[model samples]
Target: MDSFSHAFIIAIPLLLAGNAVLVPFAVIGAVIPDIDGVFFLFPDDEPSRYIFTHGGITHSIAGASLLSLVAFIGLYLLSGISWFSRFFPEGVTMMAGLAILAGAMLHILIDYLAYPGIPLFWPFSTEKFTLGIFPGPSLMILILSLGLLTLILTGRAGVRHYKTYLILCLVIFFIYAGIALYANTETEGRAIPTMDPTRWITIVETDECFVVRPYDILYGRGEEISYRKYTNITPDELAGIARLPQVQRLCYHSYIVTAERRGDTVILRDPLREEKVFRYPLDHSSLVIPLQETRSGPLPKNTDRP
Candidate 1:
């Protein structure tokens, strides 16, 4: 989910529980998982410092906990200050810690549902996991946001009445979640036969691709500023492609990785990391690597990746 989605999702409980004072802390906590991205301010894609400073550590489950603790302490301190007392309905309380923890946890869970996955049990394992619910943002966030807004505007979400809306919101989330997952499965089923994919279980579009966003199939093109297919690799060639260092690195960072062979060189790409080509969804400093795969094995062909 994006930060706005995270913010809205975290706001629900805070608003309904009549502790709207915690909403600010919760919203910040939801985005804390991505806070490390701040380092990206100074040439974020610098290979030497890339993984060490960004998503690598902060997106982890353990990272969220540590972030929550820090947030709790910060919120606790702010709760003590009398300056901001006028803003919060009841000022602040120690329970804001719980709100921060919940928001951060949801952030990790939401990311877990997407591709290239997250390192939840980092240090213990580097394995990634994902439900692939949708390649981009999920619809659950939008529905909840709209519904919550409607209730708030109609004056139906007062202290006692807000609980009813909250319950409805959760029900709507579960239903939409089921439909979204099912829709992805359906799209994958259709794409496999039509796309003529290299992998049996999945289909990686060539040249052009469509993503499974909330309620629609979104058309996407690489950052060529125009759509172009730069490479094409045969099925038998994938083994050699996977062994390439660039492909491995791309796979490590992406939830969905695909390949294309450009004559003598192999091109490894992550459709989820489309920004390397399109620059949307915030680039995250991705680089496309070209590979020279031979019958013996794969070798790095590009001395310049960045």
Candidate 2:
């Protein structure tokens, strides 16, 4: 889950718990798991470091629990000091604890529905559990948007208390997510017109940008391309790629290309960067007609000889 969803989960609970004053802080704590995104700000030496995956430490149950404990202890301890004690107030210590716990639990809950599951019981166990609620890229945005809107409308119009709103929103989120998941399952084997894996090019159309990913080898159409939250290539790999005349001339402006490993060799391709895109893997071997005639036709072929 991204920051917006994270905030929604946490804030909804806190608001419902009658901790409206702490909603903003709860939102901030919920987003702590995504601090890995800060890696994008600095330049790296190789492509491997560029967000290999998300939801490792911060999205773990340990992280969320630690956040709850910190909020509880820090405020409790600070309550002793007069100048730093206003946040705790007189009768709100229990409310604050409940708020923190609610926020932390909600954070983990939202992440469970994402592709790479969060460690719901980290330190105790490191297993990842995913509900696979939505596909990467476009489907995620659609799902999250619907969830957020439902939460807002139902919470505001129907519920009188924050707790009621929180439960209602969670209910709506799960129901809507279930429907979206069913829809994605239905489309798994369906043909997507613009995407053909046999061709060297991958097309990603969004509201803001249209991305095209191309295979740069002498004759290799990129294999098994999927839309993912994190990219395999780091800033260093992107810079190295930019120096290549073939990539610069053909792909730099169209798509953001990167390399990932299969067995030993690294294959070049464009990744589905955001959670708002869809991936379609084309099977070139299944094609009866030449690839050059369709939408993403005339792709480069793998020419490395044995």
- The candidate that wins on lDDT is 1
Cα lDDT tens digits, model 2, 221-244, are 344344431234333333333333
Show where candidate 1 strays beyond 4 Å.
Answer: 18-24, 36-40, 52-56, 78-94, 123-126, 143-172, 180-201, 204-249, 255-267, 270-306
Worst 10 residues of 2 by lDDT: 282-291
Residue-level lDDT of model 1, residues 235-306, one tens digit each, is 455555544443444545543444566556655555544744222335432344444433345432211111
Task: Give me the candidate number with maximum TM-score.
Answer: 1
**Candidate 1 structure, TM-score to reference:** 0.56
Task: Report clash pairs, candidate 1.
Answer: 115-255, 116-254, 116-255, 223-277, 223-278
C-alpha local distance difference test of each model: 0.55, 0.46
Question: What TM-score do all the candidates reach, one by one?
Answer: 0.56, 0.45
> Which segments of model 2 are wrong by more than 4 Å?
1-5, 8-31, 34-54, 91-95, 119-128, 135-175, 184-306
